[model samples]
Target: MPSPTRPSSPPSSPSSPALPPELLLLVVDAVLPPNPLQLLPASHPATKTLLSLTRVSRATYARATRLLRERCAFVDSARRLADVLLCVPRLVPGLPAVLSLRHMTALYLSPFGPSLAADDLPTATRVRELLCEVCETLRRLVVQMPFGSLDPLDDGHLGVRRTLREGFEQLHRLEEFVCLGSYPALSVPPEGNTDVWRLWPELRRLVLFGVPMDSHWLWWDIATLPRLEHVVLARPVGLDAVNIKDEYFHKLPRDDARLGRDIKVVLMDLVYDLGVVRTERWREIDPEERMTVEVFEVPLPFYGDETPLQLVTEWARRGALDGSVWRLGGTRVRGEEAG
Candidate 1:
């Protein structure tokens, strides 16, 4: 065979076929979902590449910027959120009517210091402003209270609660409200009540992290949240913890009456000391009306000179001995349900 010859280089054109600007931008947007756009750092190589493309035409910039801001995550002081509002003043005008922080679908509010106190009003107001801007668009609001002596007094707690309640009223579209602090004062009103229920009419998921509650209140709230689907209440150590009584299920207003069938609830660290008694009671409730309780035991590690094998054996023994006794009618014992 003759020696292989290299293919001739394709001829360069003085002018190439140009795609319509709108169609080109649409193609780019179609290739990437909005999530990655939010995850990209401002100085990311990919972001720079997109920016360069935007400079090529106005349509590109419009599509790129819209995608970039669609799922924005801001973990800053309330003041920062306010600053964003002032920078984009025209974005928000009225309260409850139109939220200022509406552009964000997932919002995480983390106060820089201990507690969000009265002194933080200016920043909180700004946050409120931004929240109002995007109230209708917000689906998740996670408020993480800073650990430490943020609030030594009860007043600060009350203030925070009030602000949050007010915030909820505006977030009519909110589906999840996650509070990473003790907010026992925000207990749900008794069953058959609409006053507090109206505050979060559309709420579907509520997560309470590091909050201690009375068992009665916990079950009552679960029953009252008409549209609620998921609830996570994490208790702290050495508190008058809420345990799920077997009667927990019986107390639930008949599902067929108004609220739909059983609401599934997950209890973390349902410790034997506090939750076992209630758990046993829960087992006795009728299957049809009882609220389901799924318990998860946390493994606490002990510091000692025990060998790995010995430690594992001890752990396994502990786990096996800590089994839950289920009442005859309800679901199977923890960890025994069909996979």
Candidate 2:
């Protein structure tokens, strides 16, 4: 009987044939991230390199496709993204834009400034529907859409806001949701939108960079979300107690939540190094005043890079955040242990 095959090329051999599918996969894993589903963007050099390898050979193509899984999908272009997701899966859903991500799990989208959402509402609507269809299997989502005052949330001329709400209603399997830019989606759907929790039954982390929602909307049905764990706010620091009502903080449902259950609490920055989670406290304001909320990154995608908020939720449980948790009320501080 032949002995089991090994991974490395023999030392004496100056050259060797192509690596075995398993060995090639190992090499690919070493080059790319260990967990592609976390936060890698499609255009990332690592992702692009892996994508290139998919064309090496038929065997490598099969291996790469399994590895690809569209894990680190980045929607620099919504139309392009929709086109790919619509076709990548073996079985695509039947829809106007075609929905379904049979294998993909994570997604990251750059901000859809007014030019995209406002100039062409029809295209925007299709993209939104496609995303919802993909949500059937999507576990984690990172969206960087900062519409703020300009968002037509209140005005229904474009109907973009309503369309998103209805689509998000189908994101039942979504476990983690991250919103980039400076605030939650434009239309937060009044206080009652009962289906909010239904859409995200498994949600464990909800990080909002620049989530400046009013308290009424801030506390919306948070108590009903049974699985919500971390709710980090990146920008708009110093909201202190005055800006956020105490009732909102006390009402959060998951007391045994993973980390920073308090609404808009400035907790810690999670540093992902060597698989260990290290926390960084808030930066000082003007070298003297400490900011209550720590800004993660500039709201826009072009400003800087985006990290996985799940890193914060996963590692936040290990450190001591005593007298460090900064609530919206500008002054109150607590050393809440990660539950």
Candidate 3:
């Protein structure tokens, strides 16, 4: 009854040793390395792990946020688009919150919904707002809006160039610009003094899908962008009839021919008849030419479920579409073309 020995408490459990700050940072880097080529989807295991680490501590979040920003996903749908926009209000009053729009490096804009054109009123406003938010950081942008949608966004007065300039000109750091879907030449009336291409001083790669093959002015815009190196003219199958004139590439003007360090004309679906002139042109290019044009025919069937962003990221990751490199003028062209 010595006061029941005061019911002595059990010995406290020992805690694990804290890792050094530098060591912790090293571990984080190992877990989430910088990937310039591809942006993993949010559902990916590595992406999920990085997101979980953001909540561990302030120190971890400080480092993880920067790494997270570099590997953001391709924004494609209205639902996914909303997810990024939802977090915009937490950090800054009007600015999009980090871990989503503000941190995004790649963006793919297509028809937001079955009934909604990308430029339909409120949708256009949202896209413009989102672009404004991410302009400072966005590096890759892929646009796949419906035909004539750009003109309607600005009351059908200014044309596609004006619409594009308003939404995209601010992205000074944009490295890759891809425009997909059928459309008239964006440079209809000429660029005048304010060349839109010059706005993206850091642009390195330009991919045009379904843009008319004869859009010489659009092709010449590449010269204005000092840093542009690679240009891809991808003609997917099932589009409107291909009205390419004979020797279209061979007769390209000297200045327009050298658009970039290397130019690639890619024809998906492997239409042998359609690719003949392009192949001939590719073979005709002088091996000593300062700028080279390489033609490719890939057997990419219709990707009903896939978005253009996925297609482009696949191309970027492998340096060729779907790992099947079919140089149109080379020995392997027919074998791949037959498929």
After the best TM-score superposition of candidate 1, give how far the Cα of residue 110 lies from its true spot, in angstroms.
Answer: 1.9
Which candidate has the highest TM-score of all? 3
Q: On residues 1-339, what C-alpha lDDT tens digit does candidate 2 reach at each position?
A: 999888886579567676777887777777666543445556667778777876675555555555555555667565665566556554413312222345467766653653334454554565566666576677766665544544554435666656555666677888776654445454554643443433577886665544433455555544446666445554433344333323244454334352143323343332322121122222211122211233232122344344544344223211111112212223234222211
Q: How many backbone collisions does model 1 have?
A: 15
- TM-score for candidate 1, residues paired by index: 0.61
The 10-residue segment of model 1 with minimum total lDDT is: 320-329
Clashing pairs in 2: 183-210, 239-328, 240-328, 240-329, 240-330, 241-328, 241-329, 241-330, 322-335
Q: Mark the regions of model 1 whose C-alpha exceeds 4 Å error after superposition.
A: 1-13, 16-56, 90-101, 147-161, 181-198, 236-252, 255-259, 269-277, 281-286, 296-339
In the range 187-256, model 3's lDDT, one tens digit per residue, is 3344433544456889887665554445444544555456777666665433334322222323455465
lDDT minimum window of 10 residues, candidate 3: 319-328
State the lDDT at 82 in candidate 2.
57
TM-score of each: 0.61, 0.61, 0.67
lDDT of 2 at 148: 52
Tell me the lDDT of model 3 at 40: 56
- What is the Cα-based TM-score of model 3? 0.67
Q: Give the per-residue Cα lDDT of candidate 3 at 193.
A: 39
Alpha-carbon RMSD, each predicted model? 11.1, 12.8, 6.7
Q: How accurate is candidate 1 locally (lDDT)?
A: 0.49
